[model samples]
Target: MKNKKILLAVCGSVSFYKAYEIISLLKSEGADVRVMLSDGALRFANLISFEALVQNRVLSSISEDWQSGLNHINYSKNDLIIIAPASANTINKIAHGVADNVFLQTILASTCPKLIAPAANNNMLENFTTKNSLEILSKNGYDICEPVSKILACGDLGKGALADPQIIVEMAKRTLNQDNFYKGKKVVVTGGATTEKIDDVRGITNFSSGKMAKALADAFYYAGAELTFISSNEFSAPYPIIKFSSSEELLNAINSQNLSQNDLLVMCAAVSDYKPKTKFNGKMKKSQNELNLELVLNTDILKSLNLNCKKIGFKMEMDRALAKQNAINMLNSKNLNAVCLNVLDEKIKFGSDQTKIDFITPNGEFDTGFDTKPNIAQKITELAKQI
Candidate 1:
């Protein structure tokens, strides 16, 4: 995103505060960010705070930059327009082509990719008018960042919270990097630890933060792949997400996707190797001193997947010396095009931000020295495209 000009339009939602982190993320990626605020946004966001981060005067009204005479038109010249925390009212106005505010007026004049992140109360967001307007905007080529279901500021648990700042930024990068290479490519990334239910409340799982999978997902999205993230954890993305718990459930979810040979599947989830043979009907009582439960092997998801798509799998081992060998073994056993080897010991922590990976392909082993997950993910993404 270096040197890319971006215009961030903040609306009236209380969640407009999130724009701070959004700005920081974009600037950190070397984007030239300029902010435009709605009148209602002033109540929750300070112009000075925005100006300080962007290192430029914030624009709130059309009259402020009158010296240029084409201020609105010029603002519309950004490489991308992001309407974060796009309130329902603003959405409706945009749907009806009402460019009353400078933000909307500039958007009207802009032909650049537009990304909208809607945030509002449930009733407001689900209202007929609001829903209709969103549908209209989506049909008009606007990239809508679907809100996650969470407890709102109004104390209601529903689907109206603004998307994660990371996801919003990733979607913006995707919009900016939309190109021929990955434009229509399908990428499926599996994540999180799949659980084997022992009872309604208890289950066995692993220590996976899903960050590795998330990094892969984000990298693929930024590369413009049509993305789908299958995970046990809840997430908000501008693509499809299939939720699952047990290894069986995960397999079923992946099967449901109907992947083709053109697709790319990254198997990074920590799927349970064994499941309780006899799952208790409900919560297992602790009355017994010791419970000797029988275990059964779970079907290897990667090997069991009924598709011919090119696949890359993750192999996490305890010994650094044996990690590459184990990854290579899994690569052949699981019929994978490549495998990523991660050694977990005192120095390496699970579910963390940083990772040192070794990539084993049919060709040879390449050690990717210690680096942040995002950087490693980018390298893996580039490797996958070449394969």
Candidate 2:
């Protein structure tokens, strides 16, 4: 939770007061908390008190930021959104995609992981409409933290009070554990330059140092994705590595994994485009100055792989004007789900820590400005979640 972002959407309910305790609990866990209060909640919720803990203005219907709906869109990008003290009104609206208030609008706008913790009077919670809304939300992928039997603020004992703040925090943890986009997803990454041996001591390779591969691997690991690293070069990681020295070995390594359409693969390796027409098993005598060797095309791993899973390729471009078009062409021609385009000494270069890349897909292109490899890798990881 050290750097995790949490969005707490509070609805108008007697349990609204408990959002403070929940915020305190989450802060104790080191989470970065942002609060969004519904119009109904504004009556009981004091803006000044919330501002002290959130360190920002609480999102509300009256906020000027909602004019273009930008605030809701941006705030919804958090790692997790929790509707604590979810009232019957909010719960029903959420189930049906009705966006009357800021909270409901943000819920509809976000595809990130979310939790709905319903809190209302016992009769309100038991109504057929309320019960059905809760069911619909649960079936639609929102985690529902069912209320526990407790003494209500109205002097009645029932199972409709907002769950204990501690329980809501724990449920938040469990929700993130299960719904983090990359969590438990399988990902295969290819790196290093593929080699083609002309002789035992003479081989061909590219300028790839596999630095980006390590960075990506680290990013995916932190993101909770199950990882498989494929490379000819050695690198240290906590995940398993399947080593290969040639295009054939690399293909075999990929094919051996039994990957499926649900998995993801990133082709960052600078594989040789051509190989020697005739490879020599033994070292040749100092080849004559006029020595000649025929070259032939190597297998197109990206196109030839027998995979249905989403695949992303790295396209290296030497010209800026043609870079984006080239990447789009590669995306289509190579049958890739997306392509990351890097131009030599411009957007990206060999052996550099930082990079600027354009993420191109059939939909469009997203240009990531100059940034560290790790930061770029994290951005790519986010894109991977969608693709």
| Top-scoring candidate (TM-score) | 1
Residues 186-278 of candidate 2 have per-residue lDDT tens digits of: 888988888899998888788988888777776776576778899878875556788988888998888777667878888888899999999
Give the TM-score comparing model 2 with the true structure, all chains together. Answer: 0.55
* Clashing residue pairs, backbone N/CA/C < 3 A, model 2: none
TM-score for each candidate, following the candidate numbering? 0.75, 0.55
**lDDT of the candidates, in the order given:** 0.87, 0.83
lDDT of 1 by residue, 72-165 (tens): 7778888999999899999999989999878788888899989999999988989999999999988897989988899999999999999999
lDDT, candidate 1, at 290:
90
Q: What CA RMSD would you report for each candidate?
A: 4.7, 13.5
